[model samples]
Target: MKNFDTDVAVVGAGLIGSATALALRQRGVAVVMLERDLGGSRASGVNFGGVRRQGRSPAQLHLAARAHPIWADLKAKIGIDGEYVRSGHIKLARSQADLTALAAYAARVADFDLGLEILEGRAFRERYPCFGPEIIGGSFCPGDGQANPRLVAAAYAQAARQAGCEVIERCPVTGITREGDGFLLRCGDAVAVRARRLVNAAGAWGAGIAAALGDDIPMRFDYPTILVTEPLPPIVSVNIGIEGGGFYGRQVERGNLVMGGGFGVASGDGASRPDSGALARIGGRAAAILPATRHARVIRIWAGIEGYTADKNPFIGESANVPGLFHAFGFSGGGFQIAPAVGEVLCELICEGRSSTPVEAFRPDRFQQQSAEPGRTP
Candidate 1:
C-alpha cells in the first residue's frame, strides 16, 4: 500500500474539483485530486455545456457572473478552446404568465448587468425566425452561449496536472474520517491519503462523504438526459430554453442540434439510461419551440447522474460539523457555467480562510437548519 500526504485532498475530479486543484496549484498549494473514473468522465462531461448566465435563479447570478470571465479566457487557462461560444441564450415564454415571470426575472437581475433584452411579437419573430408560433416572447442574454462539455472537464484536469497537482484517477475513496486536525481518506487498501483539509466534489456521491462526516444532507440523485440530432443545416445560433422548464436546446457549429429535458431512469449499479418517454416528450416540445428541428434525426441519447439538494441550490461552503471539510457539490444540473468561480471561491476559503464572493447563500448546513424549523422538510 502507498500513502500520500498533501495540504488538501479533493474527493472528485469533475470540472469543479479539477478547477479547484488548478487554482490551488497556481497558488503554490500542495493538493491531491482523486477520482473514481477518469477525470471529467461523469456528469461534468455529459451535460448540455451551456456556458450561460441567463435563466439562472437570482441567488445564483452572482456566481454565474464570476465565472463569465473564466470562460472568456478558457483557452489561455486550459490550453484548449473546448468549442466554447458566446452564441447568446434566449429564454422563451409560451404564455402570458411565462412572459410575466421572465420579465420579472429580467428586471430582478438587471443590476447584474446582463443586458437582457425582452422581445415579443414581430420583434421576436424577426430576430429568431426559426422559433415556432408557440414562442410568444423571450428574454435574451446576448453574451451567453454553449460549449463542448465532454472536452472541458478533462482539459481542466490536464491543466491541473501540468500545473503540479497530483491527480489520481480510478481511485474511489471508500471512506473518510477525521484524524487530529486533518482528514484521512481510505481508497480501499491500495492507497490512503492524508491531508490537512478535504473537499467534497463527488457530484451525486458527495452525500456519502457528508454522511461519513456525520452530516445528514438532504441530497438526491437525478439522471438527466441529453439528445443529439444528426448534422443538419444550421437553424439556431443562440441557445434556447423554456421559461417554465420544458425544453432546452442548442445547435453546435457542426450543425448538430443538442436538446435535453426531464429526467431519466436510474439503471442500477450507479448507472442510468435515457428515458424514452421523456425523450419523446422533449421531441414534442422541441417541435413546438423550434419548428426547424422537428424533422432532425436524433443520432444519440444519453444521461448523466447529478446530485440535487432539496431547494436545488448547491452546497458550497465549509462544513458546519467538520472544520476542515469543504463542499462544492449538489449543483442540480446547472453547475457547469459556474464551476470555475466556485473553484476560485473554494481556494479563497482554503488559503485565506474567507472568500470575497457571496457564498453565504450556499451554506452546507442550511438543510440541517431547515429540517429543524417548523414543518420544513429539507
Candidate 2:
C-alpha cells in the first residue's frame, strides 16, 4: 500500500469536493482530492448550471451573491470559458398566486438593495418577448446568471492541481475513521492515508462519511432529473424558473436548452442516475411556463443524485462531536451555483476554524437532536 500525506483529505472530486480542495489550496493548505469517477461527470455536470439568486432560501441567496465574484474570478483565472451568461434571470409567474409570491420575495429582499423588481404584464412582455403572452408578471434579478457546471468543476480541478493539490481519481473512499486529530481514510486499490483535517464534500454519499466519524446530520440522496434539447437559436434570453421550483433552466452556449429542477425521472439507481420519466413529468411543467417548448425535441435526459438534508438546507460546518472533521454537502440541488464560495469559506473554517461569512445558519450540529440516542450509532 502506498502511503499518502496531505494537510487535508477531500472525499469526492465533484464540484463541492474539488472546489473545496481548490479553496484550501488557495489558502495555503496542502490538499489531496479523491474521486470515485472522473471529475465533473455527475452532479457537477448534470445540473442546469444556473448561477442564480432567485428562489434561493435567504441564507443561500447571501452565499450566492458572495459566490458570484468568485465565479468570475475563476472564469478569468482558469480561462475555461465556462459559458457564463450574466444576462440576468427572470422567474416567470403564470398565475396570480405565483405573482403574489414573487411580490413577497421582492419586498423581503428590498432591504438588501439587490435591485430586484416586479415586471408587470406589459413590462414583462417588453423585456422578454420570447416568454409566452400568457405571462402575467415576474421578478428579475440583474446579478443572477448561469454557467456551465461541468466547466466550472473542470476548471477548479485543473486549477487545484496547478496550485499543488494532489488529485487521485477512481479513488473511491471505502471508509473514513477518526484518529487523534485526523483520520485514516480507506480508499479502493490504495493503502489508507492520513490527514490532519478531513472534509466531507461527498455529495449524496456525504452522510455516510459523517456517520463513519461518529457524527450524524440529516442528509439523504434526492434524484433531480435533467435533459438537454437539440441545439437551436438563442431562444432563451435569461435564466428561467417556473413556479414551485420543479422546472428551471437556461440556454447553453451550444444554443441547446438545459432543463432541470427536481422531480426528475429515475435513471440509474434512481439513487445514482437521473430518471427519464421524472424528467418528462418535469418537462411538462417546464412547458407550462414556456408554452413554446411543447414541441421542442429533447435530445437527451439524465439524472443526478443530489444531497438533500432533512430541512432542505445544507450541512456546511464542523461536527460538534468530531474536532477535525468538516462537512459541506446536503445542498439539495443548489450546490453548483454557490460551490466556489462554499469552498472558499469552508477552507477558511477547516484551516483556521473561522470564515468571513457567518455560517452559523448551516451548522450540521444544529440537527443533533435528530440524531440517534447517545448509545446509538450516529
Q: Per-residue lDDT for 245-353 in model 1, tens only?
A: 8689999999999999877888887788899899999999988888888888999999889988777789998998899899999998999999999999999999999
For 271-290, candidate 2 gives per-residue lDDT tens digits of: 44555567667777667666
Query: What C-alpha lDDT values do all the predictions have?
Result: 0.90, 0.77
- Among the numbered candidates, top TM-score falls to 1
**Each candidate's clash count:** 0, 8
lDDT for residue 78 in candidate 2, whole number 0-100: 57
Q: Estimate each model's TM-score.
A: 0.97, 0.92
Once model 1 is optimally superposed onto the true structure by TM-score, how far is the C-alpha of residue 14 displaced, in angstroms? Answer: 0.3
